[model samples]
Target: MRSAALSCPFALTRLFSLLAHDQQLRAYMPAQVLLNESVERVGELDVPLCGQLPNDWSTWGFVVNGIVTTIFVCLGIVGNLYHVRTLGKHSNSRLTRYLRVLCIWDVTLLTCTFGFYGFVVISTGYKPWYGDITYLYMVFYPLCQVSWTGSMFVVTAISAERYLAIARPFRKLLSEARSVTKICLLLLVAVMLINLPTFFELTQVSCYDEETNREERMIWLSSLRLNKTYMLIYRIIIYPLTVNFIPFITIVFLTIKTISVRRSAISRSQNTQSLSPSLPAKQDSGTTAVLTALIVKFLLCYSMPTILYVFEYSENEELNSRLIDISNFLIVFHSATNWLIFWRWNVNKSSRSLTQSFIFTKEEAARLTYLWANTRPTEVGRDLLYTLIRANRSLALIFANNPPNQTAVKQPRDNATTNGHLCDCRLSESSRSPACEHNIQLLAKVDSHGVIVGIFCDRIIQRLSSKLEQQAIIDEIRALGRIHYSNRVPMRNTDWMLAKQYLIAKLVKDECDIDAEDIRIVNKFASFLIHEVKCGRTCAIAAEASVAYGFYPSSAYTHA
Candidate 1:
């Protein structure tokens, strides 16, 4: 029994050694023989995988991927074209300029890379011949990488720009339209130069199966044999780190930073309002929201694929193929979604009501005037003005009645006092009339530059009438004043003085029925008052200058 047990152990050891020897023999066999054998073992080992492909692609699989990719390509092309045109119309803004470049990148990527791949798979069933053409592989392949990497770089740049705009708005950086365009062009050139190695590293090789008497083409990278280190660096380090990982991290970091900064700014603005009422609050733009949404969507769509790529390993070919298809679809989906986001953003911006504008109220108008003093009137300003006039019919009427350089005139009471009180109209040479006395109650409030800022009837009318009548008169006068103020044109001091005189003459004639000679007299008096005001201001300035120079006005006059 002991001798039989020893023999069994020896037999088991011999069997194991034979199995090891067979494995070694198989490993050293010629590649062609191995290929023939692999074809027979295809069912057991799973289908053959293309370079960097997760699964063995079949005709039907290619067809499906092609169909999905073609859909995205068509949509992407159409949407990006529209985006380019629409953004081009408003290319004055730095953000729009960046977006235009992004759209261009998307179009190029779809046409050169994704679209090309889809065409080849749909037409040729993923055959190696698709890439076997010398120029196609040498030039177009490298260009494809360039476009892909360029697109990632552009997304990174957009994130950076948005972060800076939100976190450090005062810094100039890429705020200018021309600067953004230049940067985009520079990035394109840099990406193209970076991907030039693709042309040199790639070459076509033939794989023959002697048993089946068939030949297949394959893309072989010479760099893998010529310089293994470069292959490792290019595939593992440069492609993933510089082209994918770095940009991904940067986009995520910047997007988070932007969100935090925006929130902080909003909170600070709210607090500032309580502390300093005069400080203008920072307004939010839809562009930031659109960018944020785009970044988030990009992350959601690409994060899984990127992770799979980084940690890629052998797996079930079918599952991997499906995953790859989904990943490719997500990447293409980005182009489609970007156009939609931009379109929605533009529509929302253009459709904003005048009430939402900063130039609607007097305070807002003043603020806008101060901020945009050096710039031309913007759409916001025009919309705000339109809304104001539309809301107040009286204001519109004033604009309609007062044409540029033309003024209506009315006669003033002959016996009006220098103080110009509305009560003085009762002392006119005409018979005592209550209507004349009531008409004299119109008061005009002028600013330092003699522009009529306000007008109203005297409070004596309120005392003479019931509360309801008083309210009605007050409302009427308020409307009239607002209309008059809205009609006043923006002009220089001299022009404004003349305009004010003419406006006052018109007011007198409209309020009180008077002859043409009386209207002329009132106009002359208004002109005389304007001259007197100008002389008084000039004298006051001269007196102050004399005092500052240590010479009294009387002493200066004596010297003269």
Candidate 2:
């Protein structure tokens, strides 16, 4: 071999690249020839490219991502499914309906992106056949985008609805069901339109390095240049910041005000209505607490990841791979967290009942109207929650500074007890951990249905009374007397609307054979009671106080 190598140094040079022995040369020669022969042969090489790479998830970092996201996704799916079922099983409530649908949208998104996609990726790590573009575009991106965008719209709609309720106060506007349906339809359309560009631009292409002459393995992403600026606006500014963040902020403001108002009302009112043992008080503070927690947590979940993604895409260099993984994980993680946080922060049977009982109800609107009417014309209306929070903070500071007398006066027990027992400041067994027991008890006592009716009636009467009182009541009656009051045709769904005519009709139905004249007198007297007993004190106190208040009357009052 040395003699032959000396004879041809060029051959020896070539031999160094391979083994010297014929048997060894044959083994190396085939592979070398195969590699050099054509790009096609190189591409077809049996050697594993992706397989040779270390398992990413098996490492501590990816494993944590997998576990946490999996747990969150599972919980979210279960929680949202329960909420949807609850909505379907119960009679429709405007607030409940809105929240229910929102939850469902979130769940669907989570299932696709987190549950399905995540499962596939985790199970088949570094596997070649695992990541296909067709599946990503048709199934993953659309589903995720739709859910996310729809959720944003839903949040916005909820805020807008609340704003209308708070601002208008007295208007007998659209039905909750109708309004919610319309909003949902709008959400669908908006999401569809926003994601339209995604469908066109989301095709998967295999990334190839032509110079290397090997099969490209990674997925190639392409986005349309047209109106990218606008799309960014929608995704970054409008969708996240405007649609989600703004509404969330508005709710927070409102929630704080509401808290302050309720506290003020509680302090001022002599007879505070106790929530049904099972229900939250009418002007419950928990609602604000929950809303605030939700907004804060949601912003935290999405904010950093979104910022990272923006930075990642803005530059052309390879980002820290860890950051990429983290950002991706955050997207799915948020979906899971939304469900858990919502339930955790704002859940109790009583709160649910209260939400159903008043949100979009005629009574609620009337109360809101009464609040507005009571509000001095000189002052601008504000979110009740915002005022409530300010009041609470002020009170907290006042109490904190004025340390109670150092005398061993027993701390007033904040917690209620079971077995008719009382303890020092500690919550009773039932009321410990979750503060839902009191609300539950309250819901049980109230005839939520009749309450709804009276609420609607009170609003109508208040409006009529305000108008009638503005002009002399006698004059108004005389005007009615002079008119040829022909029997009016009853409107359809008069059941839903508690109009004056409908109320009289209902009175007749209840008190069979009672003279219409007596019924009229009773109605007038009832109206007086609502004005005097139900709202008179409230109006007086509200007019006097330049602050927000929540007035909860006794729950034991019979529906008149």
Candidate 3:
């Protein structure tokens, strides 16, 4: 139930100690403490955040500076800790290394702050060590400066890396393991050096402690901070640039350029896919949607604080203090909520134990599908569409060999196509490698299967209409996807149930009714076939991204 304002006891005791030494204070006892109309700061300032506010601000300060801040900073500490642990589990790639560094410093920042404010100050009404030594010279102030500097620059570095890789994939700087390690080390050391001056800015000075009733050491601004030239070079120029402006501008520019470059990259990939379907589709692009979303979050959370530092400074003490408090809250909130962003968007990516994640139920599938539908319509949906178009191509060739008016489920008994389904023979042992491509190439009529993709596109358009048939069409797609996926799963009892749940989500996103679902069903069936047919699980990604899955050899899918 303690107020957060008490956390500034170092600043408060210093201020009142100066008053106790004043010539007017020697005139009386306890009465003189109240008789004084105003108390002015005698010497150098201790902390920027500690200062006076109006008498009416007590309740507001307690809620903001004390309780809410403590809670959020505590949350931030936990979030960053978990983030570090999670990222640490992944293999040491260039991207994962950068992410790990970002998480480590974020933990350092949040933990130090929480220790200082959330625990020490609120619990004991003072700093952790006697004479205010720890608060003044040790933990929170110094760590926060270096950690913050590290976070800002790390983000900028990551942005630059992503943009560079996309804009110039051949660049060797961030591509190699050793180079990434070197960059991470240089970034850490450079940030520490940038904030090195903060340690010398404050020093301990002797002052009378009213509560202890004796002389005690308290924090005060050091002579170095008072130097005019150092202030200009340090706070006015270097601090603003290193802390906010430089990183902010660089990230913004890089993010915009990245978006532009990525659009062109996708276009280039499409052209490449058409010209040479032999190539693996959509190779690693050196960036992820998760990082993009994180960058967006950083922009949203840090703008007000960074803006206030540069263009919006106010001379009024109370107003300025309030603004700083709000900015601090914004920062802590940013650190806390990023975990939600990470786990929400990226839960599927963890390569942890399959037993933990593979228990996919109907509800879980629905949720996963819904997320895919909403967040990645173009990326995920297009991936599904490509495979189906490829499947339709293969399916058309098989049916061409059959007599007219023959159903897909019925055995034609004329060619190798009808052992089970379009992909059944392929998923079995016979056509596993070299992919029957030598024979299929002679029968492939690209024009005959071309219209199938357009028919799928029409179903996506029907999503906007109110026709009752659309639902029925959607239901059929779900039913087919279930059967299609189950067809490759060796007839497990749970396969049908698992497939049905995800179908509900895919159906809801329909613009066209049947073809979209059919496309997704075929893609799912094809990808599943890859897993069951001994190509391994990694090939599922390639099967989803590329068409002509049957054209590639088993070795290609395994590498994919």
Best-performing candidate as measured by TM-score: 3
lDDT of 2 by residue, 1-560 (tens): 11111111001112222223444333322122222233333444542221122233345334644566567778778888877776445445455677787788878777765533456445554212213422543456555656766765676566555444444422312233445787688778877886665455333433333445455443222344123454445444564554345545665665555456645655654232221211234334555455556555555655654454233232221233344445546655665666665566544453333323322234433433443343322112111111221222221121122343442222334444321111111222343334334333322222232244344334434544353343333233223222211212111221112222333344444444656454444344333322223222323333323123332322211111
Write candidate 3's Cα lDDT for 217-329 as tens digits: 54444667545567667766787777778888889999999989988877754522321221122123323566788888888888876665545334454555566567666
The residue ranges of model 3 lying beyond 4 angstroms of the native Cα positions read: 1-57, 124-138, 172-174, 209-213, 267-287, 347-560
Better of 1 and 3 by lDDT: 3
Query: Whole-model lDDT for model 1 versus the true structure?
Result: 0.49
**RMSD to native for every prediction?**
20.3, 22.3, 15.7
lDDT order, best first, reads: 3, 1, 2
How many clashes (backbone atoms < 3 Å, residues ≥3 apart in a chain or on different chains) does model 1 have? 7
RMSD of 3: 15.7
lDDT by residue (503-543, candidate 1, tens digit) is: 33433434445455444433433332233333334334445
User: What's the lDDT for all of these models?
Assistant: 0.49, 0.42, 0.50
Best prediction by lDDT: 3
Q: 1 or 2: which has the higher lDDT?
A: 1
Give TM-scores for every candidate, taking all chains together and pairing residue i with residue i: 0.52, 0.47, 0.54
Backbone clashes in model 1, listed as residue pairs: 408-506, 409-505, 409-506, 410-505, 410-508, 410-509, 422-440
TM-score of 2: 0.47
